[model samples]
Target: MRKYSIIFIFIAFVCHFVTGQNKQLLYDFSEIPQSLLINPGTETDFQWYSGVPILSGISLQAGSSGISVNDLFANDGIDFNDKVRDRLINGMSPKDDLSGTYQIELINIGYRGAETDNFYSFGIYNEGDAIGYWFKDYAKLGFEGNADNLNNRFNLSHLKTRGEILNVFHFGVTKEIDNKLTFGVRGKLYSGIIDFTSTKNKGYFVTTEGQNNLLSNTLSADLELKSSGIITLDHVIDGDSSAGDMIKRGFFGGDLGLGVDLGFTYHLNEQTLITGSLLDLGFLYHSTDVLSYTLKGNATVEGVEIILPDAINDPNTDFWQDLVDDVEGLVPFEENRKSYITFRPTKLYGSLRYNFGETVQSKGRLDCDCNLSGGKSNRTKYANGVGGQLYVINRPRGPQAALSAFYQRRFGNIMAVKTTYTIDKYSFSNVGLGLNLQAGPINMYFMADNLLAYRNIAASNYASFQLGINIISWGKN
Candidate 1:
């Protein structure tokens, strides 16, 4: 079990097998239209809508909290390198993490804006994300090899992380500032088809007490690794480009960014309601095909002062290239293509609903399908409602939250349903389900989330799903 202890047990088993904006069944499930992508001031009486482009929408999510993978390579034989050195000397830390997300929607549409209480939307989507953690002193100095932890110290600032894959073009607007507030906003344009990052790492790695190698090691560093639109391990071993020109240069020449999203919904009375949102708030801007790597220097060592080469007609005795050119002359390694900046992993949502049975009123055409006088409309809803929500995100071992409780139903103008129950940090038996269907102007929906791990999804830590389809219109108000 050595090769840098199998690369630190493959990075602590890829940080518990690299795996949620807690969009509990599409948040307020307002007869699903992607629930206005999570509250675009919800409340749409639809006058137009469309989606069905790339099959409308789709989403996926995965999760990990603490650990999994059959609780670490389950073979039950025990001793997988002493359970990875006793789970790196007693089960992980540094806030144990691993996160995930994904989304797709090639184009979505909406309308009804010529001031009729306004509404409008636009879309294009693609997303992928990740988060990481568990850098407990580099897995306890790679499973105890700082020559017996001489002076302790091992930290390189718990090494942070970042990940991405993107493309998004958006537009939105929602307004209705009278009978109890409503507002929405959105704007985005990003297209950064791939990225990798590592943020703020600093020094440490110790061992001391030497003199003819009893022990003496040091390596203070400041690391960095950033990338964008990857591809270049010397162009993947010289195959010189083709993968549809790296997918048309990662979906149209990578690297670009900008973003925004904001929302609201209020009404303190008339059956209570309140909402909130904030998403992406973004950035990205890794200059085209960029790559960077750095490892600032500081070094010391006691053994291996270069001396080897026994019997082998030595062609200039290259003893492991003179101990890697004497550790690159005291720890130096840098590579650059520069240009970097990434952000966008921002999320937050809020909710509170209450609206009870009975109160459906939109048989709008007020006055027997009026055509000559007396017209007024816009007041329809209430087959049931009940809610609670709160989700937060922004992590690197900070700010993560979730809490949910829901129940919604509607059966008069098509069909609708929503159900939920959540408690974050990965499972309290998640639950969640949603469905919406409308027949006349078409519109479809489906949702899922940790439904009791679908009865044992290998001891599920988390799961999610979403689906969509649309074409809607309504207004005789």
Candidate 2:
């Protein structure tokens, strides 16, 4: 039973994060109020905007690199066991990951500061992100008892995972330096609700021929799992805790941290613009309700070597127990209450767009709407724009990047449409579409990614969508 503990933990850890934080559809989508969340420097034409409370902004993205549900449970006639054996235990690699991210805005509102001529934006939102790398070697060792395969070292380092849920309160000031440059900076306060990580584990287990016994099992293991706010969350789940307390924990009654975001937009020429933003460049400090599991050191056991006075034929189980106890002492599993710091998964977004076609008339005005200051110039709003965008996020394995090219079209001042084709590690043929509509002072926008995969979502690797509604004032007479 002691020998099975290592592999059991690995099998459990492989179970789960999803589509990541690549919001290509909403990166530079100035039509939606939430685009500011991704790029605070996003050019805003509205004089002021207020989201529709909790219903204002919502986003979710989920995906896996190695296998989809259809691979195992498709209607095809392959045997279920065989599919699992081939697709899961055999075909998957260490780099393959299942990860996801989600966000819900609670309060989003912005206004133009009259004194400084700067746009001020602030909001609070709940976010959760998780990622887990597939444990290939451990799955193989568990599925196929390592009796036949000698000298094959099953890596303990294949286990890498992290997850967190927190709320962020942020305020930003976007300033247009000149007609050619616009920049913004946002400060963030993080209230962590729950978090866990087991990303930097290292070691291995190998079975080799022994001189005194038929086999020698050796394990070189260094592993640790750190968690914060899990105890309270567990209590809440078991009905032993109040929901209000949990919400309080999510609102700075628990752990706390700080972060900042920076973004900028630069117009190289009248028809060209370069834009980018860096998000979540900060860390969380967790001290309360922290629990950690650690398994370190090394141990080796050659079968169950035991000797008794009754003779070798009838061995005392206590002697075997003694051997197990000795081995366990050499490599102990421990529980600890220690503080930790977890860095937020940082993301980068950049794009270069070309504006063209006819210049649209300003809302209710063919001439300049107001005085030209704060980077508001006589520059025209083109009816068509084309661009390519790049999105990258720091992952446990490495930085993953996606590239997309889009075409945007505007219909007068009432509606806008954008279509994109993106290529990433998950899919090469992912396509996205977005729409922004305006009816008087009401603003609504929707963006969907991997639209082609909608035909059979289960077969696709990644898909996501974002939508929001807000009231806006352009300050036009």
lDDT of 1 by residue, 1-477 (tens): 344455335334433333334677787675666677766877676776788888778877777766656666777889788877666445867676676777878888888777777788888888777677667888787777677677889888788877776778888887777657778888888888667778678889898887666787778898887876665323533467655555554465778889888888876866678888888788988888897888888877776554445534455666666766777777778889978888787888998988778755543221132221222223436789897988888876678888898888887778888888998887887988888888877888888888888775766877878887888767664
**TM-score of candidate 2 to 2 decimals:** 0.92
Give the whole-model CA lDDT for all candidates, comma-separated.
0.73, 0.84
Q: Which lDDT tens digits does candidate 2 get at residues 1-477?
A: 432353234323323432257888888877777888889898777678899998788888877888988999899999999999999989899999887877889999998788444789999999888888888888989999789779999999999988888899999988877777889999999999878889999999999998689889989999999988777866765678987877998888999999999999888887899999999999999987998999998988887665455556765457677787887788889999989999999999999999889887666212353323324554567889999999999988889999999999999879999999999888898899999999998988888989998899888888788888899887764
Which 10-residue window in model 1 sums to the lowest lDDT? 364-373
- Range of the 10 consecutive residues with the lowest summed lDDT in candidate 2: 364-373
Q: Against the hidden reference, what TM-scores do the models get?
A: 0.38, 0.92
Q: State each model's C-alpha RMSD to the native.
A: 16.5, 4.1
- Would you list the clashing residue pairs of candidate 2? 17-98, 17-99, 17-100, 18-99, 18-100, 19-61, 19-62, 19-63
Clashes of 1: 0
lDDT top scorer: 2
